[model samples]
Target: MAGAMMLALADGGSFTLEWTHSVEREDWRETWEVTEDHRLHLTEAAVKGSGAGMEPGPGGHFEDGWWVWAPDLPPVPALTLAASGETPSAWTLCGEDCTQLGATSGQPVQVAPCPDAG
Candidate 1:
């Protein structure tokens, strides 16, 4: 299982969400940056062991009202979610096949692609 962390800017202008998984004594972290406009940016993704493999990827653009990050890595998969306003009343995390892996409501939002997702 993975754990999630969130940090909102002091001015409430930006926020970051991160997820971490432990592997071989190393922690792989996936992070997302949310701009004031509600645009989500993939700041860092991939394994964090030695802090060498983690590289920032071109984040997704705002579409409709959601921030969508397409799968760049095979196991990473893809992701989509609400971009603005208060925490979503409900949201879903889908796999590469678009299968729902998890869903939640009224909580700190933390989302990532399927595997090795950032």
Candidate 2:
């Protein structure tokens, strides 16, 4: 993530990334936290309804009109969300403050924990 945008963690080092699925047109959300090692830890995820590429993970259950589950994937260095510029709404990053991003065409947003400077 060198030379990319750097965002300090919020008080609890937790945040959520939200966006509308392009094919499903359904709202999707992923809750993540910054680990002490400066890696991104995805804790949970939810989607309005299942569709192409919207399959819920095993053990997912219905709750409040959403299919929610905890993905068992390992921590990632970073996550990238591509922008088509045709989305009705901007991708949202919510922590201490909410930021709308990647609404422009050809612009992509990459999210990662701020790594320690050496």
Candidate 3:
């Protein structure tokens, strides 16, 4: 719960976060959805290339030029990301529209889901 943030989600809606590995120079992506209990659930993950320490998780397979898999993780109240301004590429968060998280460097960004108002 460090620096927690509460974000409202659309009913059964999902979001995507994409980033590039600093050393591997490959693209990584994760698809997350809001659970019924208003928590963040990681549904899928993909990597454009693999290297040392960049291998896909279990049950992963190459598809459409990317290694894709579903991460077997439990839903959580929030998700935290590192923002040390050290990575070669910045993080991109997309829902309705994609937005860069570059301005959040030097601190951590926490993402959580709030129950839909409807």
Candidate 2 colliding pairs: none
Tell me the deviation in Å of residue 89 in model 2. Answer: 2.6
Candidate 2 Cα deviation (angstroms), residue 115: 3.2
Predicted structure 1, TM vs. truth: 0.26
Better structure of 1 and 3 per lDDT: 3
Best by lDDT: 2
Name the weakest run of 10 consecutive residues (lDDT summed) in model 2: 3-12
Tell me the TM-score of each prediction against the true structure: 0.26, 0.86, 0.84
Tens-digit lDDT string for candidate 3 (1-118): 5554344576577999999888898999999998777878899999999997789999999999999999999988888777878887778889887777754466777667767533
Candidate 2 TM-score, C-alpha based: 0.86
Model 2 lDDT tens row, 1-118: 4535566783238888999998779999999988777788899999998999999998899999999999998988888888789986688999878988778886578887766532
**Deviation of model 1 at 113, angstroms:** 19
Give, for candidate 1, the lowest lDDT window spanning 10 residues.
93-102
Model 3 residue 110 CA deviation (Å) reads 1.2
Model 3's lDDT to the true fold? 0.82
